[model samples]
Target: MNPRALRAAGPAILLVAATLTVFAALAYGGAADPLATGDPGPFVRWGLPVAKLVVNLSAAVMVGSLVLALFALRAGEKEFDAALDVASIGAAVFTVSAGTVGFLTFLEAFNPQLSAGPEFGAQLGSFLTSVELGRTWLITTIAAAVVTILAFAIRSWTASLFTAILAIVSVIPMATQGHSGDLASHDATVTALSLHVVGAAAWLGGLVLLVVLRPVLTDRALPAVLARYSSIALVSFVVVTLSGFARTLSSIGAWDQLGTPYGGILAIKVAALVSMGLLGAWYRQRLIGRVATAARAARSFWTLIAVELGFMGIASGAAAALARTSPPFTETPYSTTPAEILTEEPLPPELTLDRWLTSWNVDLLWAFVAGFGIFFYVAAVVRLRRRGDRWPVYRTVFWVLGMLLLVWVTSGPINAYQEYLFSVHMLGHMLLTMAIPLLLVPGAPITLALRAIAKRDDGSRGGREWIMWAVHSPFARVVTHPLVAAAIFVGSLWVFYYTDLFRWSMYDHLGHVWMVTHFLLSGFLFVMSMIGIDPVPYRMPYPGRLVTLIAAAAIHAFFGVSLMMQSGLMMAEWFGAMGRTWGPTPLEDQYIGAGIAWSIGEIPTLITAITVAIQWSRSDERQQKRADRHADRTDDAELHAYNARLARIAERDAAGR
Candidate 1:
């Protein structure tokens, strides 16, 4: 490393030292101890959290730097290359730390004696291969190792994108293996923790990347990059804040639990986060612009960055300790009821009409999505209007309505009951895949964004560039093909329900997220192919589109018929096992769901067909108007030519006779 690079590493060195000091103090400060049985030695107990801290730090470094590179840094530029190098280092540390955590976790859980023997090898092999927790860590370590090499080797945009994705995936095992997984609200807890971990890493890592790149970036480039980084940090702050609250709520049973040591540490972490947020706001509002104009402001910028790094270190150390600290609510598995045994959570109250609107079981993922969707869409429309650009009012209305419905479907009664009732699940599916898209597709969000978002001259990719890239990419072309979109829209129903995917979605939070995303995208693509005002890869002729829609509807109806005709329960272990005295029995609810799939589901299909027919009519009318205008412009020359040809044919016949 150059002298400049060594100087860049100074803040991070301070960060690590600070983090280790706080983490060690908290880990050994009566906050965490081995469970009574076979208490692992202090080394094992203390080493696990410390190892986890390294894992967190490394993950932040890997994910955050790459994210900034993708979002802010110009591809093939010196700063971008430096960011990748930073990521490579982070990935290496991530691999080592993850491996250490895996081994130490094995030791803690098994309390196995260390010896050089075949039997010991056999036990270690079983622990790594046969055990879930052990296997998770083993997988995480291997993934990190792969990323280490990939981040070091790859410099291309596409390769780096995939590498960044791999980096994110490497952390999933951490999210899944923790105490959060066994909590009462398993889905919420896992989602929250996963988001928190990723968000915090991105925020801290990007800040670190900025500090490291300070020496390489020129005065003009520095402020622009800082502006970009500020945007990322702002978003990360929101996600980390929200996900933290969700995770905390899942762990602590009541407000009174704040008095507990675990909660006290959480409070400290929250305080640190708030301090960092304030620092970020100060830099964004005050320093970022001035840094480009005044050379002296650079020092102030670095000072703020150093303080932010300190705060981030405190939060990281506290978080590592929090992982080991026992929350107020213990994660003791409950089998008091069959429902609890099956769902890993107790059943909610019986379903009612009132409860349909009132009950809320918020999925933080969808909540944030809906919130951001509304905020950005409204902001874009307002921006256009302020510039005297005409954006249809109805489009904004439809978009807002769609987002609101999304929140309601994901957070309100549908989510509350979907896992328990097949009928409700089907209803949610129809809304997500059909009704919501109908509202959202016509909004032409891509068009609005293309108009509202400013174009960038720098080689660095931003929100607008990324959105454009995705829309025009090869994958988008294939998916947005009318046949492919229709197939996914119609075929996915049978494939998801008949296959293990439905069961997976019920059993796993990640699977549920995938299911929602797949259905939403499928519906969006299909709708966009038909009535969308925005640009697309391809769309068929209006008649061909109508045929596609009708065919898809028919296939969709057959799927409903198949479901109705089923003699056995789908995922009997989940829906059938939810012990309840609800309005409908499990089998009966399945039949109701089938009816919903066929009948209520077709409402949006009918609307789509009507939309296609109307558009077809308008298209023909527009074509006719164009033809008339062309004829007017030509002054009847085509007609005169036709008459002359007839005259020549008549003259030739007369001469021959």
Candidate 2:
């Protein structure tokens, strides 16, 4: 490996070692107590513990495999490649060892006593016998190890073939080993656990692979690669986030458990992930500039990767703990039933003050209004496309109203309360940041304003000169540039959410309004910069636009995942003050809320990304075809001119004769 690659390896190794040590400590020190025969509870002698151990160990192995895949993708530096190979092998070995140890641990946890007595031993034996063949963690681990080794050793199509085989084998054991296989028993826990494990592996594993490969990527080719991965990441992020929430809800049984210790820890995990995501967005935005300039930003890039990986590790650790922790299915002193809260008597209408319009909701209305105005503006533009009519007052009114309405709506009471309502907040965020901006860009509001002003023609040379200067000013160029708008939209999201500013913004009506306003404006700027919804001052090349969209979406996905894994409600106190009764424990509600934020918020954004991709591709194709035709015409014209010149020279010689 080169010096840079070698330096990269150091961090990777350290990260791997730290992760293994943590998991090993948990395994050795965190083992549960052994129970005697005839234990009162329905604990599955060894089945549950064994299954858990297998899953955790398997996860470690998967992580190792991902590290290898990353190295393969980033094979630019030979030394780094060699180091990654070694690390990959080591990771594989660790996975096998961990799996072996976990299996033994499971056996010991479940069947410590060999006695075939009437009470516990008999029941345990019966349960074990009832389990299907090839259901043990031992089988799954061996299969995964074998496949991983083959994938490492082979080249060409065989590697992918083996990888597929391994993935399938991994699932079989997961299906059979857990309580989920006992379908007759209707075990929700096992089913939920199985889904959760699979989804997490896909999502986290993909992220690790992407991060590792990102460093060695060529600048010219990075956008396409990133775009492909962005799509994959989006799907994985959604699946993992939704499945995680489902698993949590099923395990916890009620919203009240959110206040419990386990729920609190889970919340922390979610928040950490969200924070990491915001960082990812920053990294993405920065990387775009670096890529465009062909500058080496390896150090900064690695730093961000390290941070992202660290958070992923934390989230994984929290998941492991959650698996071990007991859910609040049983009654507790602080329990506040879901039904009661959902059906609670409404507060007396007479005592109501101002209506509670959250920032998100207000933003939603603003988005709708802005959308309507843009639609009308577009209609007017299309109608006037055939005729160069002077600009109408009504059209100008529509444009100004649309802009003002969006700004004011995002800055009002609706924006303030959005954070309290997770789904609504996310909705507001999407509209303000993604949807509304799309509308604004197509309106060509700046171009329209300039045209309206210039039409007055006061006949003063100075006034016209000033208008021209303003139109061509540096400030105008900066705001109209795709890069600048992207910076504003993405930067605002990160700044608002990551700092104390986010917390402070959640506290009051005005703060909320300001936050929403910023979100909408930033979002509008970003979309306008990337896509020419309206006539931009200057448009980015199609390729550049594609990169911007893909990179921004990836950043957004990271943010959503982070939010989903937050450990505590960042705004729990704020919600409490708002008279929002989320049962006795706010943790579960918060988790659910984050899930809403991550999953629901992503749907519209992803759709937008897809649309952008399709449109960009079409535009590029058309431009290419047009260029080819123009080139052909120019060549023909040149040939004709050359022939005519030759004829003239020949005719002059004939006249002299």
Candidate 3:
């Protein structure tokens, strides 16, 4: 097919592909079959999945267009404008589809009578207001509606970027709702599915944007755009693959479960994923350059994109259908323990020395974070070395070590047991806020990224451009200041604990993620302002930094002591009522946790202070060495002039007297 024709037909192709695949899969998996009881009738059984498929596809286009526009196309340019328009349209569709699905789901769940009467309206309102499922989709629809307006109105880089982020966030609620239970891996499944959904959206939508924009793109521009999109697609593929695998593993406990209908749908989705990956690789490696130089190659590439979008549609449709089909194995062991009731997972074994190193409850989200963090840093280092631009080996080592430790803190025994043990929770907190930052600050990731990322000259913002902007932005300057950073790093602990935020973090996954991110960033900023190798807008003098550290440490210790001497356990329902059969009493464990905060946490602070002192010494020595070199070069003229001026001033003073 000609490129022009292909571009115009892209949306239709994906729609048809998705429509066909979803209907087929739903039939094959018995998803559209009438429910044994509480069936909302066949129309809803079929229409709900179709609406969901639309939701997924439209969300993909919404997220993908903004992402590509932000990273690949220049603001105020035609292609950028077109991308945003596409995003707006996609968001509008997404909003409508989400609302439809939300209502249909209410009907599916309650089998309520369809009517516009007051009683029916009241029931629907209750569902939307009170039910988790109803509220989730309602939130999703509202978010998409907002994104639609933002995407249409925004033309600047920062606004577009934020809109894209908001668009991604809109899909996450949907990711959390699909077929899950009280299984231990429930959180992991939700997390993995969220990632998978976002990744696949970016991958699918970016390609669609490319086809949409090809007519508008100059030959010279297309290659660069393709290169940037390829990079995005590559990362998305990895995330989608890993998260999908984790999601699948959580769903199917037995190998033979693959023979089940749900598994069959999964196999179809997997096949589509594999096909898309292989096609992406082939074109990314061979076609992008050739397309820049040869028209024939361009044609072939366009044709391949058409095919790729079809596969993506198939994958997405399969995913939507899969959500409707019940998983093969959800026979989680029934338990009535308080811990299980509260957390939806069994209480872990007692914290022992052996389990500290041996146990792991991998948080898929942070596992990917560590994985990507290490991969990009190492890749950047390798790029520098290959080009003979130097990056310190020790920096690389520190970064790797920090990332590994992050994995341990997030996925190891600390994470596994923290929900049940206050002391273990505090241990993880200390590591996240102090020890991990200590290692990571020395790595100087910002410095490495600035040095490694290629500067784009096409008036577009790429990774390098955005990083520079963020580092130099007003927010960066303020927060990275020593005083401000110290305040946030230390003050937030008290604020978080004293407020409902602490309880929220314990109960909600989103709140937990926020807690982790807040501390990590606050700690990074504080450490960077003190001893980090990364460049910041401002830094306190060595003596001032030392003073700040001392003040911060003293306050930290006092807070810890206050906790240790508390009259009652913190988060009483959570910590005191876990019904554990091992370890110390709840109040005693709280004391241990507080002791850790006061003592063990201070160890890293001591280490940071020592590092600051060393840096100060080295700085003074370097300044002196420079002064000595200047003296040697100029025969001590500066010092002689200073002495003569002082002598003349003294003589004048004597004469006046």
Candidate 4:
């Protein structure tokens, strides 16, 4: 083998050997018991060892192949490209084989009653029959694993093809699983299982790819690659979160079950995920470019990646265990009573306007509609005109509606939930901190407003003056400043959540409304300040933008961790009333909620930071070049003018002589 191949094979070999050793111990240690119990007979007994071997061997091969591919990215490694191709193909094959074998083995283990006899289908008819369901889960998992592996093995076109296929195949199984579907359906268990499998695969697979390939990529390519990968990771993270929430709600049945064993495990899992995400954010924002620049101690980047991978492993293990265990309180003969259960919910046939409509659902609906309208209108206006103009009536209406809708949504939800209030405050936090900001940042309302004012009839004397003044106003510049916006956005989340203000805000509707409004506004200002979706009143330099992102991310990290460490509920009475149970104890539930805040919350925020940083850097570079060219032209003009003056002076002197 070539040097690169040998180096790549070392890690792969070690990983394979380690996995094999582990599996061997697991298989032999318990193989006889399952066979003796008749829960699994000779078929499973025989299949288990073979399946274990295949899974370990294939994993090694896949890792090895990925390592080899990394070699192709190194400078002066043309020969390595050929080797990479071979390894990639080998990896793809082995990954597929492992998935297949594992699936079959899982089937055998979970569905030992399957017989070659005519009554096979009848025997496996019960959808909830633990054995058959386990087998199906294994099959789906292997399928997802195969597709995810293949997605990274091929060229761009082929990779995209495989990715799309993987997404479709993976989502079908997920939807079929209980978590994504009706909780009361027969497939609920399957849905939950499928989601866990797919979510874990997507997250773990992407991390593995990044860790293995990152070291070899060139500097110029690293940022762009990171940007692309970050986008994918963001999408995956969101899916994982959404799916997890759905599964938790479905499995636990009621909020009070959070105090149970299953709930505790789920909370731990959430914390682990959040920690991993924070680490990922750190790597992307702090270490990524440093690694590319070959800064000293760059190996730290690799170490962090490994740490991330380890956390992912823990989470996966926890998930595997959770799947095997029954949910707490659920196994009891009597179900826990829900605090409030809406019956026969009605849908509105026609839209109605009400000034006193303070319902959470109503606010959320209006916010959704208004947010969409504002974004659409603003985008349209920008596309229509190259130069900035005044805010149009349509745009104005949309902005007002969107902002009002947001205010209503944030306030109403907190108010409604405050009655049961434990973490309803956190829900308020989420709306203010995450959802509202996301909607508003992209809308670029301020920029649109300024543009609209500028578009007024030139003949109107007062209109022109107002437009120019607003555009040039000190208030506009200061408020829209990147630093100022980021501070408010990041600071508000941390301060409100950490202090009595968070609790105090929940007591009354208006207080809650004020808090929510502030949060949404702060988030909007912050995101818009950092990212130039619509024109800002004033643009910060690239370095400033980077600093803003970094500082804000740091603050967010602190917020999450602080919340995770809190000993008591921020809003106890409301939470108790809402039937929001963390696990078995208030503290545990708080920890879990904190974990959710700390970990899952960081994923999107970090992604946004990285995106803004890269965009700003690229834009800054382009702008600098333009400035240089302009400066050169000015210099040339001055030189030409001087030469002309000198010539005239000489001609006059000669004429006088």
Local accuracy of candidate 3 as per-residue lDDT tens digits, 77-175: 989999999999999999999999999999888898878899999999899989888999999999999999999998888888889989999999988
The TM-score, computed over Cα atoms with residue i paired to residue i, of candidate 2 is 0.40
Give RMSD to native, each candidate: 2.3, 20.2, 1.4, 19.9
Tell me the spans in candidate 4 whose CA falls farther than 4 Å from its real position: 1-38, 41-168, 178-202, 253-259, 329-657
Choose 1 or 2, whichever is better by lDDT.
Answer: 1
What alpha-carbon RMSD in Å does predicted model 2 have with respect to the real structure? Answer: 20.2
Tens digit of per-residue lDDT, candidate 4, span 4-29: 34335434543454344333433433
Q: Candidate 3, overall lDDT? A: 0.91
Model 1 lDDT per residue over 1-657, tens place: 232544566556656755675566475446555567888788887778888988989889999999999988988999999999999999999999998998898888888999899987898889889998889888998998898899888898889999999998888768876677557788888888888888888898998888788778887797788888999999999999999988888788998998888878888889989999999999899889998686567667777777777778888888888887778886777568877776777788888888986999888888899899989899999999899999988999999999999999999999988989999999999999999999999999999999999888988888788889989999999989999999989989988998899989987778899999999989999999988888998979999999998999899898889899999888887778787876788999999999999999999999999999999999999998988888889977788899999999999999999
Q: How high is the lDDT of residue 608 in model 3? A: 91
Give per-model TM-scores: 0.95, 0.40, 0.98, 0.41
- Candidate numbers, best lDDT first, in rank order: 3, 1, 4, 2
Q: Supply candidate 4's per-residue lDDT for 206.
A: 45
Please give the lDDT score at residue 197 for candidate 3: 89
